[model samples]
Target: MTDFAVAIRVYYEDTDFSGVVYHARYLHFFERGRTEALRACGVRHCELLQRAEPLVFAVRKMTVEWLAPARIDDLIEVRTRFVETRGARFLLEQEIRREGRLLARADVEAACMNRDGRPRRLPADVAGRLAARVRDETSRARSTGD
Candidate 1:
């Protein structure tokens, strides 16, 4: 939808000796963003695994840019946009920001996979739901100029 956002508070464990969030920790933040976004669309990972043909998602590729730093205790928002789905894969764009200031961003490609690790087309029902959510949000955003 417009962009699913989740607020997070930076913790000491997320920071390095320099008192800034460690680069790799940003990945974790982005992951949480993605998970929450899916949840917002009524898709839950646990439910996916319980389907008739169990399914899971795996990251195929990602590109990230770190534009600024977030220090311990800083509150940040992770915003995720589900770009599109292609074959067995889906694309997402995520940004980490603090008080409207861009901190980092990531573009992700993820694939749906069977338990055996072979790529599989996303379940039709799941894809439909995601598509509907995207469409609804797009219209909402357009109407509000968000």
Candidate 2:
């Protein structure tokens, strides 16, 4: 199981007039986290696109909780974990943290879709690799009692 962590700095453009990160910025952070996570697992999105079965993943649902405000210039870490993968969809748990404190959390459900935008099953090999990462992450969490 593989989990990925990406560090991002809140920029002035990511904030509102009050200098705090805007709500939408969290979604962007999560997107980057997911992309990096896949890359770390040796699954490049571009390569996926070039496959014979060429497919992409799209968010089916997202539930987010804002715990604290993040200000511009703050170094934030986006942690992404593949929580589950089944059938035609996968669930991801992502969080935004600053100095070990969770600033926001999101539960995302994503579906694999073909170029025509219809739901598709993930290739067996791809799913197996993703499942391995999920299992590893779960084991690490259990070991840490988290």
TM-score of each: 0.92, 0.95
Overall local distance difference test of candidate 1: 0.90
Candidate 1 TM-score over all chains jointly: 0.92
Q: 21 in model 2: Cα distance from truth in Å?
A: 0.7
Query: Across residues 27-122, which tens digit of lDDT does each residue of candidate 2 receive?
Result: 999999998988887778898799987989899999999999999999999999999999889899999999999999999998999999999998
lDDT of each: 0.90, 0.90
Question: What's model 2's lDDT at 7?
Answer: 95
Show where candidate 1 strays beyond 4 Å. Answer: 140-146
Range of the 10 consecutive residues with the lowest summed lDDT in candidate 2: 1-10
In Å, residue 37's CA in model 1 sits off its true spot by 0.5
For 1-146, candidate 1 gives per-residue lDDT tens digits of 33789999999999999889999999999999999999988889999999888999999999999999999999999999987877898888889999999999999998999999999998888788777766776788789987
Q: In candidate 1, which residue pairs get closer than 3 Å at backbone N, Cα or C atoms, i.e. clash?
A: none
